[model samples]
Target: MEHSKIISAAMKINQLTDLNTYVIDNSGEFVFYHEDISIPAFMPGSGQEDVLNLYNQMMIQQMNQLYSYTNEWGLHYLGYSFSTNDSFAVIIGPFMYLTPDMYGLSREYNLRNNESEDLRSMCNQIQVLKTDKANSFASILQQFELLINKEAVPIRIVANKDNEKYRKRENNSIMNDDADIVTMRYKLEGNIMHAVEQGDKTTAIKLLNSNDMLFSFSERFPNQPLRRVKNLAIVLSTLLRNAVIRSDVPAIFVHRVSEKYAYEIEYSNQLSKLQQLYEGMVEEYTDLVIANTLTHYSKVTQKVIEYLISFYDKQIDKNELAELCFTHPSHLSRKFKQETNMTITGYQQMIRMNQAKHLLKNENISIEEIAWLVGYEDASYFTRVFKKETGYTPSQYRENN
Candidate 1:
């Protein structure tokens, strides 16, 4: 099989599914890749990628050989045999984690790194999760990869040209003026963000609809006009997520909606579907700003809400939240209840239970595991809370849905 066919198929499937897709050559080069910036960036602050790259090179060095591998960091790889006599393999994914088996990831590891600015930069890009929760989501990602590999389709890969042709094209591409394209991309991003910040839905929608220049896609497959639109949708969704955050929408609300639209954009294989989501996402954030009267609530209450949504998985203290919000615990508590018509603990429980519903629907973990994932230490207590909210135990919800 031509390697480009596999890469294009992986990219299409990635757009349809909520997973990052990558194809590594036998020499461990990232020849093709698609990763959403919406997914939190994470990497060990050392030579982790270099070490893993060496392992991949070693595994696929021999022709007709294959390997299924995982490491201390959250990478699950399946090396597929691609050549009969030549040593070529297609390695897919740097998945989250699988089976919650961290292999002592939390413990100190062996990789060495100089404490330099590069190391600090790597650490800043990293985001860590609890052992149990990371494992759950990682397993889900593994399953997605399995389905993609099984049903991987053929895509019309644009063929690379000979050296003479390639050099001529490269020279022409360099000479071509692309300043306009860059300006258009950035202008749309900035203009949409401004509308969202100002809560001006009219301006945002007008900008989205009027911009044939910004939203136009190139022809890929003859019948697939939306082919180029697919890639643009990823960038558009990312910009819209930032707009929603700047609009002062609750972080929890932003997280859920951003995730929803990301998947929606992925599976939108039709031009109309892509256009609908494109226009809707821009307007949606602007509408949130219009509706969210955050001034009605104190900044302390708003900060507390943001903090809880961000660190919902970890055990949190009331006093600590109050201190961070710069208010007396008692006064903040009263203000939170009066403004939101819900207590602080009550709101936190609501969000946790909502997330549990998501995990129950999407993951293959046990009820006990799900409880722990949503921050309930005692399974029995979690069941009680779940039953009270949804009239179904976690198992029943999983089974019924």
Candidate 2:
């Protein structure tokens, strides 16, 4: 039930945004998007650095590593980001066990047949009656709605009419008119189809991986398993073949190859059952990879985090952590940033502030003691940092609460 809750919650929260979100800090956690509500002309804060941090957090929390397993199947993590230039890159990790491979495409089947016939007939009529961009948008929306209602896959749709910035991002240049956006998608799709025809697997794969691919294909075919199956199966197959040929592919990828290919190549129930077994292996060990990352370093940063959490509000010296984690001043700073996305001092300060919020709400601890506990020997300095974090002083917070 706990596992189910986490999965459902993760899927539920994914509907809000297109930004790559993450569930950080611990295992099997929920990924969330804190919407960046700002004017179009304004630049996002801190550029791509925060984006990378968020991605890392999501990867770590979802156990979206190569060695993690689902309950019954093994899986691999393919992380990619599509760009304005219509190019992207992926980070393929080692494979891990996940869930058993079920024979039927349950989600796809539901998506295909779940729409009311009346509404379905209406969609068909709309697709035929209107030759303009609006009808095209409506058709895409209906298909997207069906996919969302049935399969629970999170997708974002921004009409070219309302989203000029997104259009610029997709096309890599400013657009003069809405028709241009439609033309751009058409052109991109043509490029994708051309690549597919020319046996350019790399370009074809890139197009198929885009948000637009999912949109266009889902609308065009409406839940046909063959349309969906070829992409996933082919990618897994390619990864497997590559691993075998290269000899450097991880054990998990080899296992997936053996399992998926057995089903594709042999087509026996026994092989299918074996595929399930392999999938489970992928999910489980992928989680193990993420778990190992937390304790992966036998070094000081982990010690610093653990010690600070244990101490709660207690003040400990930076020098004390150096001895405890066996890290020198500069190296410790570097290590914390490398692993945790924040400087050691910054993390400690965040910890102190979070702990202070909890303590002030529950306990009768004074601001001064809370300061001392969080390693700030001076009450004034503690107050300053606290205000910086929460926008309220200790007394102010306590009084307001």
Candidate 3:
């Protein structure tokens, strides 16, 4: 977390010439760096003086000189440089303290920002230095920054023996191209869906909040272009198709925000009508895909449904009813003609309107409460919508019948 530690690590790394180095600590913790890369550890467990004496003897035997040390916060950090910018460092703390988690983190700089490439190199250097303990490897990098460079890059040094998920994320995020952004979008979207399906709402929420999808979305669609309902619907449609074919859920949710927001703010009858436009595209296209009735309708229909359902409750969306009916949008459109039956938007409006009517008729709550309860942002709008749907304003209906 500290910036100084990373800078020190970078400075120390630039000072080291040979991959062969030794860390003999009396600090009561095992030292590890990269195995099969650097010299074996020669730990001389004794008092600091005795260890320093032995270090001196070993250095004299090798004809080396001039190590750097800093005393601050009641602890000491030392830097041993082989050249101007290629060396390593160490931080020593109190006699009784647990070492920090240092595995896979860049000690020479903070690994948080635009310096990922440099931090990655430092990680590689840690391996070359043969430091094995996650904490010790990280300690050297942290101390290296403070001792030599005077700053640290934001980096984490957690040890992952076999997992390469981060590696995939980083690799997939290369370049700010549409393909790259879409890849990240689909990957994260799929991840969130899987989490949700597994009844891991916590994990799903965490994945959503992790900024990975946010970054991808922002990068791909600047000025919040996806904020528009129509644009978002199209993206969702595209992504849903991709998800169903590729079985990617992250992509589905990533593009469903438009539909989500529409559903969220559908209380105004006028807006509810507008929502039909968005819902129409999603349902029609998805049904085509699910039914496989058309050449264009691939497996993408399920993904679109998944995307919409993720943001809207299943009860309100009538997912079970939609699935059981096997009703294609076109078939219903032809049959209902003027009735507006089976269109995606029509179904959505029907559900919203039904809920509104129930709240108005069954409860003594104010129209404003009903507006919000049914997802409208404006009470007056809900009034107009109620009038259009039922031939009377909410108050007028209550007054007459």
Best by lDDT: 1
Q: Write the per-residue lDDT of candidate 2 for residues 1-401, one digit (tens) a residue.
A: 13333334334333422222233223323333333221111122223233343344334332212111111111122232222212211122112221111112222223222232222322222111112533333233223223224332343332112124333333443345446446556555444433332223443444444323223334434566444434444444443344243323355645654565545534433434433432332333333332344455545665676665545445457677787777686777777788888876677677678657755765465787667545666899989888989999999998887
List residue ranges in candidate 3 displaced over 4 A.
1-181, 197-199, 210-215, 221-260, 263-401
lDDT of 1 by residue, 17-99 (tens): 43445555556666566654222223341233523453455453543333444443444443443342233444344343221
What lDDT does the true structure give each of the candidates? 0.58, 0.41, 0.40
| Native-referenced Cα lDDT, model 3 | 0.40
* Residue range 317-346, candidate 3, lDDT tens digits: 334434444665554334433433245454
Q: Can you rank all candidates by lDDT, best first? A: 1, 2, 3
- Tell me the TM-score of each prediction against the true structure: 0.40, 0.25, 0.23
Give candidate 2's whole-model lDDT: 0.41
Better candidate number, 1 or 2, judged by lDDT: 1
What is the lDDT, from 0 to 100, of the residue 344 in candidate 2?
67
User: What lDDT score is found at residue 196 in candidate 3?
Assistant: 39
TM-score of predicted structure 3: 0.23
* Per-structure clash totals for the candidates: 1, 48, 57
